[model samples]
Target: MATAPTPVRHRPTITRTAGDVGAVYQFACPCGATGEEQAARRMALVDLNEHVLSLPKVPAAQQCRTPRTHGNQLWEPCGLCADQTSLFDLEVS
Candidate 1:
């Protein structure tokens, strides 16, 4: 007799939500993981990013780079890269 194939598992999506108190936020994942309430939205975003990075088969954040516009390079780091850096810095501190 042929054996049945195993079901595939999908990664949970992480999202940020406002907390009960004003100016506070937290992140939750479908997998039942949650972040502690944070006063700064940036902290919530960092928590979400950390969860994403912990999952299997996920790609690492891209390196920071200045984008060129009309033959001139912008002075700011890419938003995604900046966020990624901030997440790591927070983790280390």
Candidate 2:
């Protein structure tokens, strides 16, 4: 039986300052298909927070990827949505 590969362990870059800190994380999820035709999708970006980053602990049935950017070192969520969670949880996870 075929199985999905394990999540990649990334050594994130950490920066600290009087104001706040942030890190950049990058990963790729492969498309489910056969042969060379199957392409690998990718995600990457920088998430900033005063604390740390984390994500919920769940077994990934399929690979996932995300990318982010920080226009200002100040570091804040792109938008405010009730459903959206903080990057702090995402970075640690």
Candidate 3:
């Protein structure tokens, strides 16, 4: 039987760590996408945003790909909207 190909995990990731000169910013994702080092935190975030927006939009399967990670949340049939913010907003009060 034909099976679905392995799902390509495309998540915008920003990994930053300290270095000799200063802090190093890395814009990388599971889709094998990367960028040059960014010295500014804001710039790195911008890079991440651009990369994320450029990627193909994931269907509303109750998944969160932002910041590149398959969050531990499942799609619920609750009457709430299926937008990204409504699904992954941890600070929901």
**Steric overlap count per candidate:** 0, 12, 0
Quick one: ranking by lDDT, best first? 3, 1, 2
How do all models score by TM-score? 0.42, 0.17, 0.51
Give the alpha carbon lDDT tens digit for every residue of 24-79 in model 2: 23332232211111111212322311112443232222212222332211112223
Predicted structure with the largest TM-score when compared to the true one: 3
| Per-residue alpha-carbon lDDT of candidate 1 for residues 49-72, written as tens digits (9 for 90 to 100) | 787666543223333353443221
lDDT of each: 0.52, 0.27, 0.60
Highest-scoring model, lDDT: 3
For model 1 the local lDDT of residue 52 reads 65
Angstrom error of the Cα, residue 75, model 2: value is 22
Q: Could you tell me how far off, in angstroms, the CA of residue 61 lies in candidate 1 after the best superposition?
A: 19
lDDT of 3 by residue, 1-93 (tens): 122245555566788989999999988877788867899877888887787677654455434444224342222111223354456656655
lDDT score, candidate 3: 0.60
Considering TM-score, which of the candidate structures 1 and 3 is the better prediction for this target?
3
Q: What is model 1's C-alpha RMSD?
A: 15.5
Whichever of 1 and 2 has more TM-score, that candidate is 1
